[model samples]
Target: MSPYLKLLFYLSGISFAVSFEIDYSNPDVVEYDSNSQIEKTEKVDLRVYYCSFCGGCVYFHTKQLDPTLKKIGSYIDLKNYPYGLTTRYKKHGKIYFDCAHGPAECHGNKLHACAIDILKNTTQSEFYNSCMMNSTWGGEGSSDKDAINCGKLMRIDSKPIIECANSERGDAIMEYYGIETDKVTNPKNKHMPLILLNGKEFNRAKDLMKTICQTLTKPPPECKSYF
Candidate 1:
């Protein structure tokens, strides 16, 4: 791996050790005698993968870092932070994605855990912070009304994809948001697909959130849950 990746892994290991609290339930009572064992696992994993593959990792990295940086913190505030975390990149500025792929290159892969973590850890301040950033990434309202607006925007942005959802319940929700399934082209006249879906139509923002939620459906709850 590259040096950057290595560094990230090292930092991840140290942070994980200091940050995460181990939970050894009855099933693993005999595995180790103390939390130190758990901390060891975290360090090794961070070294081996350079990543926890958890959204909480993103939570700490983004929220605890500098605000001017490109992390979720720069765009969001601590109050908007999801449930599992403690801060929102409060001290540092934006940093790059640190994943193999860089930021501004999102293809719905690296961001899943991060976003879900934030949603779960959200506070009123973070909510308002998100709203002002663009009101698109779980910011501002996020209620049914805001969801409708987001749905409308998503539909307008992904016409063909949204239409493919045609008879899906998700599509029905999108319609309720006042976003009709149709084609839209920017000034460049390029075709734009509205709505995003893993398999079916995404009628509401929450519908799309299902995909984000999938990233956290694992053990140790790598990415904390807000809902």
Candidate 2:
């Protein structure tokens, strides 16, 4: 991995560790005498692979996943990757492609990637939610202005994000997402909003909340109904 990617991983790990407080007093916790062996259950990482221009992906995220995510909060670590669905075209020895949502969607993807890099955790979510909610998916036109306006509303400096979107670094990040997306085993997994729980592919988008609750080693109070 590149140094930048390494940094992103390191920062994400730190964020996950610091975001939640573990409860050792849970009733399920086994009290161990000095001679008794103890078992460890690691926290699950929930990664979302999505495309900026996919209408279903956008709707699912904003309407379904976001609310549950907020409810679950620190119970799981969340990672969002923006993958483009267009195939690259070679012309005059240069490679280019038009996104399903148009060039504006490509720009929006770059902007989202840059926001994640520039901000951490909740701030990243703030920008992402704003952009997704205001984006022009399933409709006409681009979401460039909406994304920019959202950044401004969040008090983030939009200049760096804009510059990153146009830089080689942004291209590298997008390529990384593409490489990751291609590794999925499912033939129909080329579509957006591919969700993974604990590094395992998770289908059944409608049962997302239940699936997440089931996977938790020590689910929070909000997950009681699902249990």
Candidate 3:
């Protein structure tokens, strides 16, 4: 990994460790002891591997996942990777990329990666992402411009994000996301926006609330029905 990639991993690693995990490996998969074993609070690790321009991915995140986080945000440690099904290669001393949805998607994916790196907080970055995704919800916004507008709306400085997304650092981060996405074998990554809860495949979107509710040793009040 290049220096930038290492830095991105380092940043994410620090945040992950603060969440009360015992064993951490791939960004996509991590295991933790039940909160009972640890005096400090433990969090369920949530990982989502997605591509930015996939309509289904966008809808799931912006429409479904965002709302779900509102209730379980405190109980979860979420990591969102944005290069699903994208490939990269070095050509003529420059790194190039091929994405599932073409160049536009690749650009969007890189933009997402940049946002993650610059913001350094998945939830905060996701808000930025939700903005960009929703801006293009009707297929109307350019990736770069949407990022800036989202940043403005969210009161974030998007200048660095723009520079990183258009630079080699962006390519490096995208590559990092690709490597992380490859570690997802449980659901076999059959599709983008593949969800992993506590290192297991979680396919039931409707049961998301209940699942998280039941997973935690002490379920939250929002999951009252599950009690």
lDDT string, candidate 3, 97-160, tens digits: 8998899888888888998888776666776776676543235333877777666556678889
TM-score of each: 0.16, 0.69, 0.77
Candidate 2 lDDT for residue 104: 74
Candidate ranking (lDDT, best to worst): 3, 2, 1
Clashing pairs in 2: none
Model 2 CA lDDT for position 200: 76
Segments in model 2 whose C-alpha atoms lie over 4 Å from true places: 1-42, 89-95, 126-130, 136-142
How accurate locally, in lDDT, is each candidate? 0.24, 0.57, 0.69
lDDT of 1 at 203: 33
Candidate 2 positional error at 22, Å:
26
State the local distance difference test value for candidate 2: 0.57
Worst 10 residues of 3 by lDDT: 18-27
Clashing pairs in 3: none
RMSD of each candidate relative to the true structure: 21.3, 12.4, 11.8
